[model samples]
Target chain A: MDKLQRNERIGILMKLLTDSPGKIFTLGNFTEIIGSAKSTISEDIDIIQDILDKFDLGMIVSIPGASGGIKFIPSISSEKADFITRNLCEELSQKERILPGGFVYMLDIIYNPVKIENIARIFTRQFYKKDVDYVITVETKGIPLAFATARFLNVPLIIVRHYNEATDGASVNINYVSGSKKKLQTMVLSLKSLKRNSKLLFIDDFMKGGGTAKGIMELAKEFECEVSGIGVLIKTAEPDRKLVDNYFSILTLDTVDEENGIINIRSSR
Target chain B: MDKLQRNERIGILMKLLTDSPGKIFTLGNFTEIIGSAKSTISEDIDIIQDILDKFDLGMIVSIPGASGGIKFIPSISSEKADFITRNLCEELSQKERILPGGFVYMLDIIYNPVKIENIARIFTRQFYKKDVDYVITVETKGIPLAFATARFLNVPLIIVRHYNEATDGASVNINYVSGSKKKLQTMVLSLKSLKRNSKLLFIDDFMKGGGTAKGIMELAKEFECEVSGIGVLIKTAEPDRKLVDNYFSILTLDTVDEENGIINIRSSR
Candidate 1:
């Protein structure tokens, strides 16, 4: 058999690890695929390990048991996280995203990758530090951030929709007093989505009257799920009937001056 | 330097080539990481080259000279694409996620790694078959699929939202008739999120009214960005207006039998 180069060897290993997120590979698989000795593969792993460490892309964890081969750890450094957060704030705090009367357009905050990646990483870092089982958010604006957080943590994301439908048999519906619009509205979530006593991290785009957030919280309670953390891309900071605690934000909006063509964005924290 | 495993070395090399996306790496860099002689590393590359071909993930193109190391095709196979489509169908068809209103709760379909990873692979394989600078979707439900797809394609994901706000400027706004309610609603997206003429793959959770989808299509046109492809998890198959041409759906629901609690789903299609 022809010999293999070091660079070529590392490339193959990364693919195997990424393709199977949680699966541990065995040395035998490599031998069969590459037709190389186990010793040669071990040396290749060391080379791949160093390169991964240098780039801060991910980690190659090796298990000693019969079932263990290697797994890649998805990680984000503080520097990268900060870079993403700053970009997100700068980009989302623009004039075009502002709504007709006063609301800010927030979909941009969750969409941009350069920004979302950071939010996802930071949220993941914070979530890992806490005891969160999964990330949860209410649709249709909160999905991006929730998805990112879930991806980073390697956990599932559950969403609560606006109305209760006959399709999902048993759902917990919550009616919250909309402090802003001052009306009662419904929020529904599948009972199976939220596990009992499971830790959850909540995320959304904006917080105004906090009614929706509050409603989602109530939905969590209905499932007996624990709210571990709350993170938002922006907040109105209305200071009344606050929906969440233990939250973080990329930016805060103090006020929106439509007539003056001025919008205030809170300092990044 | 210590010797390394051949397969491990190949993994490291592939990452380096992928780090720069299209850029090729030099043999020197590969040699340095593996700490193996150039000849040994070159031999390892040969084995990896074939493995890549076998897995149908991509190809390792070797470049000769001082500046040349190796390059990855960053391509996917048709088999992977079909696998993804099948997985998406299965995920969306799960019995537990069926909503009472004849809607399939899609939160789980996009959030599950096993499902998201497959969906991502398919997007990269079939739609973004050429160049996709970004994965685009509307807030707030489509975010999960978009994020995963973008992550796999190594591109950014952009979210379009309703209501133009100040935070997202340099954006294009368009009005469209919504499918769910048959009301005209405005959608906004950041111009800066997408580049001119760049290819974008649009994804969404469900297509009932296609109003939001139409609005998104208009927004893409306004931005002068190319709509490379369109995809959805569920297509309701509305009678009159068709919002997207190129798309895929896991399940197609024909009608909702509200009285008998029966839903006619297009499982085979």
Candidate 2:
């Protein structure tokens, strides 16, 4: 391949780094691809970092040592996170979202790729420091958010399901009570999903009683893995206390006035 | 913000356009963000496009008209797609993945964020021209791949579940025969998940009898939507005839010889 210009090299670098967040790329690797000197590549990385800082996109972190290399971290600035959460609260507060039995219709936001990407960025910023080996979530609504978070963190995702299938092979099952409903439910995970001593980050779309989070913790223990971090998009305020104490939530749902058609939700911050 | 240099502007543009795939951005929008003239921004976009093409990252499409701008289309070149699919087949055919009952354990691959991103890029290249309004899939293994495809296509995802929940409000349920197992199963989707007369793309991790795809087609009909496309990571070769005639698959699973501990798989291309 011919040598690439400075702008072209920068463009390719930015695309490759951001596309696989947290994956390390040595300077030598870039030098080989772009045919540039180590010093020139280092200067290019500094410029990319400056541009990232100026735009509030993300940060480029350099690991020091023999195996060290630079990687992209999907961290959102606090101001930008605040703005995103506020917009989300506004969108969720719309009266039209209030559904029967006081349930706020959130499938639209939770399943939306663009919105989920932003939400997962916030979660990544919160849990990226945990050095999570895997991002785990219960099947259904939480899958999208958890998948996006796993992508941003450059880790594998594990989905625990309500039931086991033949395709899953041997599995481990645990039962836990729903936090709010107080209903018993079972969680299933494939035995081969995680490695022993792995650290997991539990991500979900909603947390009403934190039952699912607790269930995930119990399930993780069965595999000798640890739940290092927990993050959710929304949590209810009425519970006051949850099954698990340490968790990060983007929004707090104060109440859903079914009769009056009002949804009182706010940013957790 | 201070004015950005040409390379800096190109970096930002590449990051923004690729991050939110298929999202249109007007020249004025770029000018306001980068503090550059419209003509200069145009030139930056041209450079970014060339870089993207040279690297086979993706393409920058120009949409010209009122209420139109430029969008990034996540298209993988055929050579790259072939290389990825072949690598996938080699990894999947490992003897360690052969499980009991002739089932190949694939949760690790399907749930892997990096692998899913590459697989979804291939799917996006196939279906992006369909102008799909939504990407839908059934619960369990397919969620991650479907979510990634939806992200690349910049569309909302609709997950059809096996059971109903109150949080989904009123859902439309349909029963279909499992093509391989020949057992009847139900699929439920929220009534409000899709707008009427929308184009839908069904994505999954594996296809046996294509019963799930058929079920999805039936469910789409209930919502007055059309199943414009179907894509899966792997399909069984035994069923030379699938329930669904038109679908794209990345790999063909010829046989999993449980007795002899041999697996035969090949790239669909």
Candidate 3:
């Protein structure tokens, strides 16, 4: 049997670790794939680890048990996070982003995979320690962010739909009052989407009066799950009184000038 | 400046290429970051390319001329894709997935990032040559798959919403008949989502009568954009006739036994 070159082993190792950010691959598995000794694989990982650390990309965590291997934890440095946040703030503050009724047109950012990937990294850094079973979000807009966050956390994403449908399979629907609009709304979730006694982290693109967040909490109750935390990309300053507490927001929408078509925003650093 | 070791250079290069799957990075940029010469970076890429080829992973394409350097194209081998598709089919065939009215409950697959990533890879590989400006999908279930495909294609994802909201700016709304339910449904997209003469690929989770796909075509016409392709994860076989043609589907739902909770399915391959 031929031995794998150092460059080849490192290249494949890098691909495996990066493809699934939070998944753990055993050293034995790497050795088998590369047809190398465990010691050689460990040395290769050291080099890979050094490169990741120097570039502030992420880290390779080694579990120290018989069944343990290596896991890649995706991360961005504080400097990079700050730069991304400020850039997003500037983008969101553009004059044209101010839609009618003080709503901001920021779907461009929400669905931009590159931008959302970075934002999800930041959100994961905040809640990675929570041992969450699933990442939850209310449909339609927040799906991407929540999906990205769940990808980083290596958890399943549970979506709460606004309307009940026969396709959802025995959903639990609840009526809640919208905090901002003060109108009755229905939120639905399939009973099979979540498991009982699970921990959930709720993420959304925008938060106003936290009415939806509050509704999510109520829905989780129906499934016997706990809402551990809430994260929003942009939280409005109006209706300063929020329906839910204990949430993290990256940016705050201070005000929107409808007549002048201007938006006032600030980062939550 | 000290030259970066081969292992370190390969590690970081792999990370850079894999992190943003389809994004291009210049040789000059790599040299500047690693403090290495162009010749050395080229050699490193050769080694990385060889490794990728050996493992049946994605490949690195070197573009010529002044504007190109290198781009990472993500892919999965035919064997792997078939395995994933079969696994997904088995999962979907479970009796619990059959809801009332013969609808299959597939929200779980839509929200599972790991699965969606693989599925997106399949879709992107199909339409990678189309030079699409945007990957479009109707909101809610299809967002994750669209976002994943857009990420791989290195394009923006445009979500068509069911209800127009103030946050969408000026949206173009059109009502279409539900091909299956025979009901009138409204679908919307922000007028600003696409540019004139742009190309788009429409993707969705399930296709019944292809009414939504047809609506997407009409909406794109409003923006003066062209629908280049359509991809759906699952298509119902009962709709002997579809509203759109030249579409790709991974799985076909032949029939559903709602009483026995059984689903008849087949692989498109």
Q: What CA root-mean-square deviation does each model show from the true structure?
A: 6.1, 1.0, 1.6
Q: What's the true lDDT of residue B254 in model 2?
A: 97
Over the stretch B1-269, how does candidate 3's per-residue lDDT look in tens digits? 46778988888898899888778789899888898889899999998888887887777877788888898888767787788889999999999788777788888888899999989988877888787999999977888999999999899999998898887888899999878878998988888878899999999999999999998998888889999999999999978799999999999999999887789888887
The estimated TM-scores of all candidates read 0.71, 0.99, 0.97
Q: For residues B123-210, could you state the per-residue lDDT of candidate 1 as single tens digits?
A: 5555544567778887666677777777656676787777654656556778888877788877777665677878777887678767
lDDT of 3 at A78: 82
Would you list the clashing residue pairs of candidate 2? none
Candidate 2 residue B105 Cα shift, in angstroms, is 0.4
lDDT of candidate model 1 versus the reference: 0.67
Clashes in each model (backbone N, CA, C under 3 Å)? 62, 0, 0
Please report how far candidate 2 places residue B64 from its true position, in Å.
2.1
lDDT of 2 by residue, A114-192 (tens): 9999999899889888889999999889999999999899999999999988888899999999999999999999898
Residue A255 miss distance in model 1 (angstroms): 8.7
- Model 2: lDDT of residue A25: 94
Number of the candidate with higher TM-score, 1 or 3:
3
